[model samples]
Target: MRPLPLSDEDHQMLLKHGKELSDHERRITDLNNKMTDTLKSVDESNKYLREQNNHILEAIIKGNEKNDTHKQEMEVINRQNLWKVVTIAIGSSSVIYLILQQLIHVIH
Candidate 1:
């Protein structure tokens, strides 16, 4: 169908409204682009932080393992030392008892 001709005043109004719509569309596009860039930057930052956190956790686990090994070694050393002290105390007591018995027999 053939379109009806617009009057001058109607044409002017339509032009004005078209310009305003174009401006709004451009502003919306700019805002959408900015939002996309911001989201990409945030995603990159999150990825970097996750990698660093994984490294830190691995280091902590290694440190804990080393600590456990040292504790076990110390426990073994302490047990050995305790046994040595007990042996020495028993030997000294036996010798003292023998010496006292011999001295009493000679005096009587």
Candidate 2:
């Protein structure tokens, strides 16, 4: 095995390289921390969005139920109104026929 002797310039070059590697490592660590923070923020935001979506879905369901109830009530009212109209028409027709019969008998 041969022992290698490093010259002054070579030592200086190695020092420069070492410093650059150290700086790069620090930068990598900083970037990793920033990425971790970003991921945490993203996760929190996703959770919040999920909660909001659930709330909105619940509101929609409740609104739909309310609308169904309203529709049913309206249908009941419409049926009652229809029956009232039919009854009134039948009564009015019977009264008019009686009046005409009486008038015809008097004429005869």
Task: Supply candidate 1's per-residue lDDT for 67.
Answer: 100
lDDT of 1: 0.99
User: lDDT values of the candidates?
Assistant: 0.99, 1.00
For candidate 1, lDDT tens digit of each residue in 24-81?
9999999999999999999999999999999999999999999999999999999999
lDDT for 43 (candidate 2): 100
Residue-level lDDT tens digits of model 2 in 1-108:
996999999999999999999999999999999999999999999999999999999999999999999999999999999999999999999999999999999999
Off by over 4 Å in 2: 1-3, 103-108
Per-candidate count of clashing residue pairs (backbone under 3 Å) = 0, 0
